[model samples]
Structures are given as structure tokens and as C-alpha cells.
Target: MSEPTPTTCMRCAVGCGHLQSGREDGHGVAEAKGNPEHPTNEGADCQRGIEETVDPGGDRLTQPLVRRGGELQPTNWDTAVGVVANRFIEALSNGGGDIAVLGSGQQTTEAVYALGKLARGGFGTRYYDANTRLCMASAVKAYDSAFGSDAPPPTYDDIPKADTHLVWGANPKTAHPVLYRWIAESAAAKDSQLVVVDPVETQTAADADIHIQPAPGTDLA
Candidate 1:
């Protein structure tokens, strides 16, 4: 069999490289082994990659669908596009704050930028927010306090080599399963200490060397 094209996993932000073998819609399979040449994954694919072979394109929502009589019915692409565009234009002119655009930081960099421009520039709305705010805000704030900027300095590879790890207010196991694998590997093989602080008792917290659960809404205290 011929080799498949190398592409990154769109499933999550890990962006692990995968070899996809097949057409866009037809029967196909993807084999995901980490791209060692990749600066991040280092030839190690996590659970999502291993499971990509099953239901490679099974659950994807392709084509446009609209709810008619509370039932989603497939519609032509042009018709769906027109309807959505018209509704967006109407919302802009209707003078209502009820319309909000939600974006994801896990999206590709270009995809995020395009969505931002669509909301802030094209639609004249300033309520663009990424899901990362709820997950990594404290870590970002901590970095900004010390480095004078909010930026992720080290990649996943660096996590395994770091001496100290501070996981605050985020759960990696359920939310970021792949990254959690790296964390566990780091803690076991590298002797890196894990410190988790969260209000909820998450899988990551259960595994941490030091787990601190403060009172709800008392993160500042």
C-alpha cells in the first residue's frame, strides 16, 4: 500500500501529525504516530491519535443544515450561507446585545484570526472571547507577572524537563487528555513535582503530588 499524506490532527490543539489514507468522504483510515521531526510531539502520539483510525470521518458535521419545525433538515450550501449571512446582518442592525460570537483558542492560528476579524472588524462587535480564558487564565496571569507578558514560553516537550510544575484551576485529564499524558510521564520519569490547585477534584488533581482545594469562589483567598 502507498503511503498517506502527513497532516496534523484537527481534533485538538495538540496538532499531532497524522498520516491520512483515503479520500475526503469515501472510506479512509488515518494512522497517527507522533512526528518525531515535530518540535512538540517528539514522535509520541497520545490516545486521540491512536483512536483516529476508528471513525476517521464518521462524526464530522459537513454541509449546512437548518432547523425546520424543530428538525434539522439538510439544505443547499448557497441557501444555508445566504440565510446565515442575512441573519448576521439583521442581528447587526437590530441593536441587540443578545448576539454573541464564541471562539476557541484550540482552533488553528489563521482560523482564530479570521473569526476575530469577522466579529470585531466585519460585524463591529467587541465581545470576542476564547475558551482559553476559563482554562489557562491563571497560568497566563502568572507568566505575565514574572515575564512582563502573557505567553507560553515552553512547549509540551519542555514540561517533561521542567523541575517544577504548577497546575492551577485547570484539569488536564478530562479536558486535555493528551497533555496530561505528558504530565504523568514528566512526573514519573523526570521527577518533576506536580502542584495542582483547583476548586473541583479532577483526575489531574487526584494524581498530583500536592493537591490543594480551596473554597469555591475563593481562589483569590
Candidate 2:
């Protein structure tokens, strides 16, 4: 095996640093571990990060494909690029009524910025949105309303210092295992109270000092 390459895990927005072990032949990642020097995770990793590094190219599209006779067929990159460019040009010439870009929050910050620039600056389209809007709109709105901004006030470092942790509708054990470990460790060390409010009894809730199972959509009430 070759030397481990230090990289960040982009599996989620948390941005956990990882040291990936790969071959010099550049075939694929063999194994990975958390980077101890990372500020965000600090030698902690989630299952998703581990899975991603192990099978980085599983079920991935290596070549571009185009729909032909109602079936997607592999095609050359030039042809694929031409097809998409032609469609975008046609849409622009026809007043861009059907031109829109739908992005994902899973995309890297650079990727998201490039897409935004392409949509707004290159295509001049206002019909650009991301899946983050659907997933985090309510939470962002509440934060903005309360704090006049959508930024999260607390960092992961604050977990250990907090006397009480009130987790709502988030399963850190599955969704964010690294942070969950910190929270669990803090609770154990400080004997801090942990209040979990979720419709389902999740793993995090199981370890909580108080688990409040509110009815679906009735948490605010």
C-alpha cells in the first residue's frame, strides 16, 4: 500500500478530515481514518465517511450517457457536451423559459459556487435552487427569525461545555456519528442532562436522560 493521503471527507456538510490509504496505481481507496489534527471532527469519523472512502467509485458513472430510443447509451464526451450545450443555447435563444438548475447540498463549496456562477452569470437564469432549500428551509427560517441570521451560533466544541443538550429531530448517531460521540462522551463525563425530542425513538434518544416523543408535526405545539 502507498502512503496515506490526507483529505477531507465530503460525505456530508460536517467536513471531517480523513487520511485515505490508496495505491500508487491510483485504482481506488483502500482504507481511511480520521485526521487527529482536524478541528471539526478531531480523530472522529462517521459511517458514511468510512463507506465513501472504501468504495469511492461504486455505481458511479465513468462515462457520459445520452438518451437514445428511450434508453441511455454511453457516448463520447464531446458528443455529450455538444448535446447539453446545444440544448442550453436553444433554451437561451427561446427566452430561457425552460432553463433551470437544480443542485444538491452534498456538492462541495467550490462545485456549488461554480454551478451558481454558471446559472446566474453564464446562463443568466434565476431559476436556480438547491436541495438544501427543501431540507433546511424551516430550520434556517426559524434561526433567521430568532437571531436575525441563519448561521448556527454554537460550534461542536460547545457540546462538552453545555450543561444540557436538547436534540430535536436529528439522529447524530447515524447522521453525524463523530459529533454524537462527543456529545455522548460529554454526557458521560459531566453527568449533563440530555433531552431528545423526536417522533421516532432513535439511537441518540435511547441514551438520553429524557426522551420526549412528540407526535409528528406537533413538536412546535
Candidate 3:
């Protein structure tokens, strides 16, 4: 196996950190090990998350392609960017309201922030949305109910220091193995309470100090 090279996993929007290297047995395989020091995951590795890191990026585009002569052709970055800008300028000239952005869920926090800025600040468009609005609706609602804002105040660093960890409607054990590891380790070290509230008893509920399973669609309805 080649020496493990530290790399960031872009499998999901979480952007977990991991060490990737070649297979030791010369089997042409790759193994990914989560980095314990990463603030995001804290050394958690879900089976699916690790599996994505091993993919060779099949059919993924490496460069910009522009349609030319009735076919898409690889072009330089500057040319490709200019083409897009010109199209956007043309659209804006007609009406900025015509432009809209529906951001993907497979984006980092920084990417989403930038997209928001471009959509609102740059384009001055009100027609903007993100997949997070659909996928993270529960988290958003919880945050709003708790803090009157759709953003969490506590960082991951607060996990280890807290006397109690309450995971609501989240199954970190399967969905976020690294975060589950962090909570489990912290609770074990400090004898802290680990409460999990979900509609179903999941792997996370199995690990929690307390599991509260409300009827499906009945929590805070």
C-alpha cells in the first residue's frame, strides 16, 4: 500500500476529512480512513461515505466544455468563463429577474455561501433556492424553533464540552458516523447524557443514553 495521503472527502456536503491510500496487497483498491483531528467529522467514517472516496470519478468532467459547431468541445477556462459571463450579461440586460439559481446539495458550506452571495448580491435575484431547503427542512425548523434562526449556534467543538448531547431527528450513527463517534466519545469521557429523539429506533438510538421515539410525523406537529 502506498503511504496514506491526507485528503478531504467531497462525497457529500459535509466535506469530511480522511486519509486515502492505495491497497497494500496490490489489489488496485483504495481505503479511506477518517482523520480524527478534523473538526467536521472528528474521525467518523460511514460505510457509504468511505466507499464514495474510493471511486475513480468515472465519467466526471475535468475541464469546461462549450457547445460549438453543433457539438460540445473542450475549451480553455478563460474562454469557457467568458462565454458564460456573456450569456449571463445578455440575460441580465433583458431582466435580472429572469435569472434563478437552484443550488445542489453536493456542495460545501463555503460553496453554498458563495452561491447565495452570487444569487442575491451579484445577480440581485429573488428567485433562488438550495436543495438544503428540502433535505434539511427538519433541522432548519428545529433551529428556528429553538433560536429563532435557521442556523445552529454551537460548533462541533461544543460537543465534547457539553454535559448533555441531544440529537433530535438525526441518525448520526449511519448518516454521520464521525459525529456519532464524537458524541459517543464525549459522553463516555464525561459521563454526559446522550439523548436521541427520532421517529424510529435507529442505530443512533441504540447507542444513546436515552432514546425518545415519537410517532412518525407527530413530533412538534
For each candidate, the alpha-carbon lDDT, in order, equals: 0.74, 0.85, 0.81
User: How do the residues 1-221 of candidate 1 rate in per-residue lDDT, one tens digit apiece?
Assistant: 33666667676776766665664555455344566666555666666665754455565766679888999899999999998888887888865343578887567778888987887887777677876575569878988987887886777768878776788898877766767778877876656788899988988889889999999899965
Report the number of the highest-lDDT candidate: 2
Clashes of 3: 2
* Model 2 lDDT tens row, 1-221: 77887888878777889998886667778888899899878888877788877877668887899998999999999999999999999999976657899998777778888998988888888889986686679879988998888878788889899888888889987788887877888887756888899989999999999999998889875
Instruction: State which candidate, 1 or 3, has the greater lDDT.
Output: 3
lDDT for each residue of candidate 3 in 1-221, tens digit (9 for 90 to 100): 68877767876655678887877766433888788887686676677777766765568786899999999999999999999999889878866788989998877778999999999889888888997776788889989998998988877788889988898888877776766777888877756888988999888888888889899989865
Q: Tell me the lDDT of candidate 1.
A: 0.74
C-alpha TM-scores of all predictions: 0.60, 0.81, 0.63
For model 2, the stretches where C-alpha displacement exceeds 4 angstroms are: 1-3, 21-28, 56-59, 95-97, 146-148, 199-201, 213-220
User: Rank by TM-score, descending?
Assistant: 2, 3, 1
Looking at model 3, report the run of 10 residues with the lowest lDDT sum: 22-31
lDDT of 2 at 66: 95
C-alpha RMSD for every candidate: 5.4, 3.0, 5.6
